[model samples]
Target: MGTFSAMHYRCLMPHKPSAHVRRPTPQRPMRVRWWLLWCAMWCLCGAPALAQPAPKVLRYAMVSDATTLDPVSFSDIYSVEVAGSIFEPLYRFDYLARPVTVKPQLAAALPEHSADWREYTVHLKPGVFFADDPAFGGQRREVVAADVVYAIKRIFDPRWKSPQLPNFAAMGLTGLNAVRQRALDQKTPFDYDAPVEGLTAIDRHTLRFRLDKPDPRFIFSLTGTVAAAPVAREVVEHYGDSVGDHPVGSGPFVLASWRKGSQIVLARNPGYREVHYDEEASPDDAEAQAIAQALHGRRLPMVDRVEIAVIDEEQPRWLSFLQQGLDLVLLPGTFAPVAMPGGRLAPNLQRQGIVAQKLARPDVVYTVFNMDDPVVGGYGPAQVALRRAIGLGYDNDEEVRNVRRQLGVPAQSLVPPSTYGYDPALKSEMSTYDPARANALLDLYGYLDRDGDGWRDRPDGSPLVLQYHTDKTLRPFNELWKRRMDGLHLRIDFVPGQWTEQAKAARAGKLMIWFLSWNASAPDADEFLRLAYGPAIGGDNLSRFNLPAFNALYDRQAEMGDGPERLATIAQANRLLLAYLPIKAHVHRLQVSLHWPRLQGYQPHPYLRPFHAYVDVVPNPVNP
Candidate 1:
């Protein structure tokens, strides 16, 4: 392992020819026909050089395959950024991971909520434009308020049938539930019949949303990638099924092209505006300054073009990075700090480096046991006994230190660190590995090895076979689990399956035991509640665990206005989830990323957030 060279040592100098010379005599006649070109060439020769030269292109890799390019359809981080580049969102999470401010390119200001917290009003920034539309023969149209209303309504449209319907209640629109009910009642054409009393088109520049209940995080919910973006109504209605392939958005980057499973290309949007504007400067001046900053330093869309190459495997990407084939390799959370060739990076910098510099952004990893197994009687004695035993047998501290390379903190609560209202008291309840406690629980629950065949049996003389539905990624953890269970005469069956099949089975509640982790949006309790206690579509609640008390707190949190009341409610929900032990909170896993020295402004984001921007990347070559 080597420490990266301190970034300060790198120098930026513009490349300039050592000497200037007069043009060749034969070229003089050609200049007569192109006088403007000749004059521009002469002026360039006299001008002073800059300290830094702009990069022409950016190339990077995505770990997970993008499910879709449609913001309304995809939920993965990769898809959001891919779609985000093409579609402008009303707001985006700030560097601190708070949804307090607007991105400004699409949204002009933070949404204003009524005193009752039921209604929201958003004013559009003037004169922002989308990508050139073929329908309009390459003419860019100014973004309007109607586009905002249409985008939100499209989520609930029966024709679109988006998976994001449940989240719309946060916007105070209750029409989706009615549409869902009508479908269940065998009604023809499950149209959105309920008049959305909450949403109003207050002219063409202002939009308002009225909620059925006072939601403290209503505005925060609207800040989601799906709701925050504005869609062209004509494109959506005209293209119909083909809209995703030919989408339109008002973001900093436009979708130049996408080659499925190969690469996605993006180009700068000419009409883009800065969210952070100098009030004294005109918008045109600000746009020009933004372009200059983007092409220069500190802030960037640093390159003229961006190419996101699709690379599924990590090792190949790592190999390419070592060979200098890649500009940067976005490492997933799986890899830890490893030795690198000193020649490639730097050797002496490795041994004395700060631990924080080598690690990834902190995130939690959890293992959820499926309590609703057909053989286990759905959270009955067998499943509870197994979960209790497993909880008491595994050493979380050791896993955090050894397996995760001390890059993570042991987590006992579902709520991750750095989030609002995360309680320290919740840490006390996590159970460490205690064989005696595990054995006692199993013994008390009627598990005994009466047959003396090295396998335990239940009170009814049936073998206590523990089946774990896992993937290859979890093989090491599975081995540890198997070894630990062996001491208690518990037979562990490691069932292997493809990742997709295993995930489908887990979602359907067909798996006996499985692993689950909430890669949260903001480390909030609501993030966990949505997956754990919200509505169970299938086996997603593998533990078959539900507490009305927890749901009540979540509901109360939704009803209560933002501030202390809501914060307390969230903390209570987190604490309750920990107490119930539905899932073992392992530790907050850090995302480890690698980059070439040429790249700059490579700040790490929280968890799985995709913060790719050409404005923020630059090369660190010792010399060109």
Candidate 2:
């Protein structure tokens, strides 16, 4: 039960020092002369002594296994974090910089935008090569502008059915939509070779995009690795429908080995283009300044390998980090008190030289009322009243204090703080909690107790029961909700299932109500607002909310720059969402990460996926 023994169970290689052998010194002058002659001969040969290899593996754990490796096929945060290492985007947020700044990753520099914001031109960096694979036919292919074009075209293909297609579809590309419709109508495979005037490759390294309408935030969309990463045509053709299992990209790391539902190993990509660690931290942050000084000019991918174990339970994940079986762990809210008592590092952890990084994430968790479900769905006055009543009855402030342990902020609107277009001064009906008003609304909207059953019946006199889909992990929160619903005489039932299953059910419009969350992919409010857009119903819009007024405001704000006009449009959209009550926005959870002192250059990014290109691990000394 020691740390080293625990590491064996997690498939980690423990250090074993070499045994030392000693020889007696020369006792006589003759023996001394013989030893002196041997030393002289050894020095003349110029041989080097054996030394131990430096530690170069970063072992970590995740709360759940990644569902897919395809960058565009899934929208989950776990999958996106893994795909980010295998795929390279045109731009990425700087690792140590505050206030989120994007810098060129695969591109040579920032894209050139036209005055009207309808055109963008990007130039790829030379010498970038994809990982070696059988699909290349033993030929080394360099990344080109056509590769980027082909990747974007795959998103529009019906066969792949990328979940992030709406992001590109909203751009109003000149001829892209027509090609997509043709493929859909003919029931044939998409033509990747077909020339789309809107997406053109001017040269081997230059790619240009032409939009029909003005889009100031179009550049931010390209920063996502899911839709913007380059994909080789031959790789896709060879892998066919199983392309997600075989990811090949020009990134810092390549998928070396994988054991599904167990562990994943990533090794440094030898073919990756030359890149170095360079960033600026806040002037007042001493810890950040110290880390920057140590890794300012080092070559990227300081670690030679990365091993991630799938530890679904929080207790084991926490123990793994405590025992040094894992290098990093994001502390769960339930264990915050045990790990960082009173919002400070625990005494035992501090004695062990463990460091904790706290951050306010740009994310929101909410319960979605499926608009397609007859029980809890619609924009009518009665449906809105019911949803508002439930929203008001379920006190988020209590949930934060009891369940979250004061680790989150109660959300006022869907737009999280620190993002563009977020209005801190705006108040909405869902932000308030009043059980008295909730009871009155339910009673006035036709829900009443019939036959002295103690439970209220639906307006149509059918047995009223609201089914909520959730997992065992959220039993505490579900119990609280059940108690609140009982006070209103509303019967409730819990549907227990895994997170993946519930996500699929929600997307298929089979669930009545479900708890879900969204983490921002960019610093703009457009990323969060587009989740409820009408065109994204089958994709990011799990609630299936479709309001023409909200859509109009969303579209208008998409074209306007960050200013008073755009802020006003965003406020209008928020009002529409609040009025309809498609979802009950909950809270913005705080992120707390714990790691060993040896793990340096560790920074938390609200939106950017963890790439670990600049992270370096110092080796611990072996016991003698």
Candidate 3:
């Protein structure tokens, strides 16, 4: 474990107001000469002769909305990403964007394990205050050892409603036996059960954690935004239902307000401190330093305010930035100015001294055909026809190279080649979209236009009507699918709504086809295969693809521990999913995003979301 610390010193320097010492009063040439000298002095010292210097605020926008504010309730990347900005965990990843070491966040030092690796001890960082204001009946006080104990307990508290309970139980912590038993036996009220027997307060600034087994990745899990953060125990106990909607955490920003589907505002935490990296500098030096400065002892909204206005449509988000109303915007690469028709967005940005960046996002999009549905049962007549239709339906290569402008690679498998355990050969096995083969297969399958109506009918005399469910988030992709599927005699009906609703329809077997993606900032094949092929992991597994063989393989991979053997098992599972054809990976779109001229630092983090690791957004000019 490496200590994360920063040096602080107060320095008083000369300054002059650049605006007030203006025009030399237009009274004398001598005065103008003196002004030039003063300006030179300001530049040399990195300060103005009569100007005050201070921190600035950074404003940004999100294309997608956060599903839940409750950390323990869900583990979706989007929610976690937002949570990362507002919460603090015990440790984080290194500059390589890997969880190379553990550091203290709410804790003062890295945890120490006993000889058996089942027992652990940790020291808490003293004087860490919650963001809530004490004057408003809120407890804005230093963090204590008991807070950590409470947080770990809440993860398994049935009444607290944490979605991470199962995962927590999987950690095999014997100390939580009492908590689990109490909840199960109804000894404690639904939400009042405290679950850990090993968490004890050595002092106000120290805590100890004892586990039942050796867990090397256990510390990394503490880096997670949800379960690892210590919330205000009093606020949570009293506020109850309102805590999730308005959380009080020990981070740089506090929940100012949320208007639901409209906007969420966060004011800076005055108690934040700039922590220094150890003697060695991490590769994320630039971004890490900026983020540290912005969070520690910085004034709110470096300027007057930082606002994220809600716009349902992506076009307006781009337009607002084009007109200089917004500072930064993240949108799909296809709609980005460079990838847009006639180079629209790029030119506009250049005119305003702004830059448009197309970044390679670790996100993949696919169409999942429910293999377990009665109407779409695997190997059934209807299912076989549907699978054949997919193979001959769309020209993926053409779409990837021309329509999407190679902003993405033609996806042949769920896992991209860049990820661990992903096979490169899977790309060649994907469909080539030959019309002759498609027509012959359809005729052989009894999908013929017997009534001579241009659309083919099944043996049962019903025309094939494919209900394609997609969210409004990717309207462009949906439109392209409709146009591309026209030649297949497929009546593609598009339904655009919220993804959550679509997900519910998928799980209930109401959807014939679903277009969606699994986003992973860390390029791990397990993240993709585990969700797609494994027994429907919550909101994922749109296809309802349940294969005993794949499920067995997935379980074995998880149990195999961290090594090459696990990687091999994952590859086998992915291959099984591909052979079954429950999913058709379309294209691996490159992520593109833009920022205002004022936003100082906005970059991608390889292992996690940008908001998690290192990023800073400051006002254009230093605010006084």
Candidate 4:
């Protein structure tokens, strides 16, 4: 069967041309108009030139589907990936800038802060309009400061059950948490109409944010982040609970069609504001400079449409990419030997104009030993010993060499590479592999063979079986895990399940253990540390770790500016994660993105997700 080119799928979605359509001549004056039109057409162009040009389409694939399209409620990278295309944040990362510089998107400029750094004032660019929607009574609606306020308020509203409530509230937004508490305590609807001193719309285009205390890096929350993208209040109220299904935004693309878990298609927002390509590049960066020079004056989102398919497995996804069904794919490490041997693109692929870019991804793969599980969970010395031993037995280096094909480094801390608070010099037991010590610890903790069954038993003489929940993609990793647990003489079971279902189970506190990775959304370690924060149990803190001392350290670090004091406090939190052993941190992965030559000016930003607007589709006839 003939599949796609993104060209094939674009035809399946609705076509709403953003460009101006030509009006025909009037009825009575038709003959005269036709004569004049023909004369003008003859004078201006030939028959071949009269034909309309095909719309440019870009295509790609992902391993998983987004949890939700709702901008306010999602925490997973997949969901944010979809939301990033459809929503517009106040600020965005500079497309080609190294070190990831934050520049204005909807905001006129960066905010001005008060002397004490407790307040920040931002002015929105005038005439920025939202895409045409029913919520605006069939009229074009310009985005204002109030829309941003409403977006922020939605996170605090209890009805939404947003996972970001703890995150934004911790940013020192003064009345944000109190309002949420009031709604919960009084059992009333969240009062969005009520005044919030911390988040105030000064006027139609100006917004002022007042915080309870100084937060030097709070602006990072506003830059090209899904949490900072503003959705219209009218759209939310009109759609009610179904707003996620009907995402209406002023971003470069509009959600044209969604086939739930199968495919996602987006059309260029014809009504998108007039913006031009003008990204920054370093002096020595030839590739970025060339890309910027070529695309400098073009209108934003050079592609006319985008199609992303959900492809789960490695071999099929790789073959699809090779066959030109998809223009770009995040190349899995399993195929690194074939695609880029010795960290260089193979000659055959290079001859086809296939480009490869690799980096040490700013993320950490970790196994969560659920703190709520009876077998794996507890704060006591015996339980701690069991977790620590398990952590010590598994070798991250082996996984990197044997499983990952030397595409990653053994993770030393919860904080990922290139982010603040990641002390490479600081050592911990997170990556230690000592079977002797692990065996001793297991024996001392009473996790042993009482019935002489070869496998270890619980302290109470019950069966000590560990139920590990994971998706099929991690089967190789799971095999290594099984072998390591065998060394500890511990019995374990692998329960295979879908990512979406298993994630829900993990969040509901029903899973004993699950392996997952957390990629950095911003250039901050705070995102990683949130996994251990007491209040984030139902959110990013999948482990449900709730230690008072650890929580205090997290809070203490958050309150201070980016300096030695904050770094010291963050260090304490990292050490505490090791002591508690709620999670066994593994390797920081190496991300390899392979794309065909047709996808122009494409480069993977370390953490930035919304990059469709920055890339263009100039089809290569040679490849086709």
Candidate 5:
């Protein structure tokens, strides 16, 4: 599964510091002779004469506060990005590889699979130790095969209610689902000690998994940071529900301190295993070559520390990047024009030696209709017609041009570009904008402007009003939606709420219409199709779409390898989704990230969470 971020407008808020903040000391101007004398003395003294401070720390800014440090508890990109540094998945994709390649991280090598493709055995690298924590009784805890088993089992524990349970359940792991059901039926705590035939610790260094069926996409799940990362059992037993607040792992960085919504500090893990930075970049990529030249062969985690501040509002985040308060910033599409005018770097930023990296994200942004809601729910022809009309009325191309500033491509289907199942040749009903056709469809479905109130009424003659759940951050987009709906005499009222609150409401089926984006975690089409799977409702399937045909096709595709058969099934699934109109696919976003010249080896992976192990901080006299 991929990470989803609620689509909303983040208003630019003015940054205000605390009243007790200290002012910096003024620098006195020195004479040219004095400066020349100091330089001469430094040159004469050579390496031992002058002492330099340690390499600079990496200061990054996040748009919102991470909801959790517990990997499986939440699926938000922000949480994944933050927790990823502290956790290590068994396998990770190469940083600069074009055709994504999985490389072992915590595992000694890739898993060896059985002939039937139902069993997988992984061997762990020795000497990997967890960060020092009070939960370990002042002793270093080496990550072992049992730690991996414990981590996977936690997802099945009913008490945790992990959102990733569906992904694991789909694996058809023998005896695991039965255990989850037994615990739920008895209303008792999950028996962590109970043995499941699927998961086994063959030895201190080897872990094995036995699935009931063949699933070629199973390895993709292992590459994700959520269920694959090893977590110490003692630490979870100590912190319990509050484990998100305290994270201990064997990664390049460890969480030093986190102040809720304010700031986060991560220090280099002193006990981390020795790993070096190395990568092969494409010969055509000059930027990659430049980064490789500056950082290749350097020890992992080139920076001493990583400090991140949560600035939910975009204006302050952008200002911080401009004023040098932050070393890197992920520019939102709303502020793309300000940062990169006409799809080119701003002259001012270029003059200041700042670099902007732009790439097409392997993701899709769309508005989902709650299939459980009374007003918009059901699979009847009338309901489907109403949804199709609404989708046709809203102009995604216009939104991309005006709101997104051409920073995205109008989506024809749920699957975004660059993914295995995405079909660029397929044209969808939602991709067209025909107001007359939309109005005709509504009229045919008995939806008309009754009582001459200038708004359509339901078939039952009740007042029809679509309550759109959104945050202040999405005010601009909502305004555009209102205008579009008004043309068809459809009323849409906005219900303002925070991203976190709206996300909770969405999961509870309390939303009529909501906008969000899903970024793929792997290169497979399953990541996108899983969002509409019937069984995934209330989990990744926020829409609660439960079409039986779509569900069957989803299952069929899951069982097949990545081939023509899988692609054919995927096409069938896409057709069903478009026909049902459960979601109005909007666009695939383009990511534009900005960073200082001092920050090197910064490559953006569309699917991979932020990994700073290979990043270095070079001294820049001009920026300093």
Candidate 6:
């Protein structure tokens, strides 16, 4: 799942320092004629002959700090994006592909799967070495198949309580779940040495995964965000709970320093293998082709150091970008109207050598009502009516136009556009905003103003206040929500808190209502649907929706291949979501970014977390 900042911004390319040649000091000052000739040559060539190059440092900013850097416990996309560079997933998506396609990462090539698609065998590339850390006793550590085995076991260790555990349900490894269950049942530490029938390290450079069932989409889990990224056992053991502070991996970059909730710095991994930059792209896609031509045969991670700072406020973040403190800035929606008016960069900004990338993110933002909360929870008709009325009362179109600065499309369903099973032609109550209809529904359901305090009460004459939990930055959104609820004579009170705390509270089902957004890690629309699945309530299904019919349909669709029948099943499931109103999908956000012209390979792809690896910061800031 993608985090909020990951949804909009990432990656600032690096600039290398120029090396100055010591020419015996021009100890003797040049004569007037020679100096004049040198000035003429400089004017003609447009570059000084002895100028030193800029240091290859990429300075970037994200709205929030990463909650942690441990791969097994990575909750938000910020953590995923940062840890991704330091860790080695067996596979990743092709960099320039429109629809995401699997590509080898630490693995030498794509895995060979059995005909039933229940098993996969991967061959790891030899010579890949983890960055040197104290955990390794100052010795080089080559990533092995055993490390992959150990990495997978960490998720099931029961100590991490990994939010990523729910993702493994789709994997259905033959004996892994049994080990997890045994630990849960006996209250014993997970036995990492237990011989699991599914996971195997055939050799130093080989891994084999055996599944209990067919899962053609299982390959996507190896994208490093899910479960299979290789983390050294010793590093995790050495750091213990503090492993998030010291990530050791066999990827492109190594963590140099970190100040929690402030800044993180990564230096190029000296142990990184000799990998060249190459990306697959459609021949007809000119943008991809151009990026390919620009970065052809360059070394991986052209940047020597990446400094990511946490600058949460929009105004300061924009100001920092304008003042050239940041090499690139992900445009917050509030400034979209001015920065990229009418879907193009402002001419004034464009003239300053600014370039922009507009991407249609495969994601959805929605309001989640806790189904287990006393005020909003229950399967009763009155509870359902309360939710439906609230869903109908809120104006998502207004949010898109005003709050989002016309940077989003009001969602018709949870499924985002440009992904499998997303139907652009379908329409639903999710896209409509009618206070009148909402009032009638509430009135019919006996949610009246028993106390006559200008706000309607619950059906049982209880106060009907929606204690909405959100970040302080959502004032515009909260104002609109309060106004909409006021129109329906319902009450809503905002509770502002830190994003990390609110997210924790959300997972524990301690909040009545909160805003949540999800970006697809893979191309499947099923990822969005998992948010409403009954069994995932404590995990991804924060809404705690447990309708039996909907649950049955979710299971049915999960088992089927991506075909017309599965699409029909998914559409039917969405109807139940609207009818029950556990979550109200508001929009599919548009990600707009602004970067300097010197930042090469600037295309933004949400699926690619290690974006800094491909982009390069040239010595010349004005041009690539």
The lDDT leader among the candidates is 4
Q: Tens digits of per-residue lDDT for model 6 on 14-82?
A: 123357844443545535545666556545544424556655888889888888888888668788778
lDDT of 3 at 573: 80
Show the colliding residue pairs in model 4: none
Give the runs in model 6 whose Cα sits over 4 Å from its true position: 1-53, 224-226, 621-624
lDDT of 6: 0.84
Clashes of each: 21, 0, 16, 0, 4, 8
* Residue 115 shift from truth in candidate 6, angstroms: 2.0
* lDDT by candidate, in order shown: 0.61, 0.83, 0.61, 0.86, 0.84, 0.84
TM for candidate 4 is: 0.91
The candidate with the higher lDDT, 1 or 5, is: 5
Q: Which stretch of 10 consecutive residues in model 6 shows the poorest summed lDDT?
A: 6-15
Q: Candidate 4 or 5, higher lDDT?
A: 4
My TM-score estimates for the predictions, one after another, are 0.76, 0.91, 0.74, 0.91, 0.90, 0.90
Q: Evaluate candidate 4 by giving its C-alpha RMSD to the native, one decimal.
A: 8.8
Q: Show the colliding residue pairs in model 5.
A: 8-473, 9-473, 9-474, 10-473
Cα error, residue 586 of model 6, in Å, equals 0.5
The count of backbone overlaps in candidate 5 is 4
Q: Of the pair 3 and 5, which is ahead by TM-score?
A: 5
Off by over 4 Å in 3: 1-55, 75-78, 94-104, 107-124, 133-138, 141-220, 273-306, 331-352, 356-358, 377-388, 423-464, 503-512, 521-523, 533-536, 561-563, 610-624
Clashes of 1: 21
